[model samples]
Target: MTTQPERLQHLLDRLLRGVLLPEEAEQLAGAVRDLERRADVSDAVAKGNLRHVKQLIPAVRAAEARVHELEAEVSRLTAGQCTHSLAICETHHAKPVPGCPYPRCVAARATGRAATA
Candidate 1:
């Protein structure tokens, strides 16, 4: 059996190896990990507007995943992107956008147009 520190070390190693660590294994889970947190997002996603919501989901997931991947890479260059529960990104756009940084995500709001970039 691995000690907690050993397990944590293994988890970090896996992060370096481009593997996703399980939620149970993370030393700390981020805000995105919280289930009860009511997100403040755009009306399109919250109103269940399909046109704008579809494109945004993957982009958001890719960005968030990329951030974690980068953090793992900075400390260890051997790691790559891992799916794990993060793959549940497939289930997201699950939250609405309180604010969009993307021009398309923003344009979709400004004119009520399907903003795809």
Candidate 2:
């Protein structure tokens, strides 16, 4: 049987050490449940589009994944030449034009042309 002051001191020490009694833990859990019950995320959960809300994390993640794929495809296609002046030859000429910027131009120029450049 502890004195009243000793019990209070022990309780304070336990609290300072981050220890909670069963009743304290139960009360805290109940308070948290109440807060969650009253919390207002219906707009996010109901809208379902994740627009203009904190629930857009999954949507943003999906968009970022798509962007990564597109970026990878662009990198593979251009090999970092997407920014340069590359064009496909629509003329269907017998030989590629000299100094053309297309990747296949050199091969096309060499195949059927006798030009040495």
Q: For each candidate, what is the lDDT?
A: 0.49, 0.57
- Model 2 lDDT tens row, 75-116: 344433422444334333334555555645566666865222
Residue 17, model 1: Cα distance from true site in angstroms: 74
For model 2, the stretches where C-alpha displacement exceeds 4 angstroms are 1-52, 80-117
Q: What's each prediction's TM-score?
A: 0.24, 0.25
* Model 1 lDDT per residue over 1-117, tens place: 878557656666776777755774454244234322545455436777786688799999999999988865542321111122333222322221224444443455576654332
Q: Which candidate is the best by lDDT?
A: 2
The collision pairs in model 1 are 16-79, 18-80, 41-96, 41-97, 41-98, 42-96, 42-97
Task: Give the number of colliding residue pairs in candidate 1.
Answer: 7
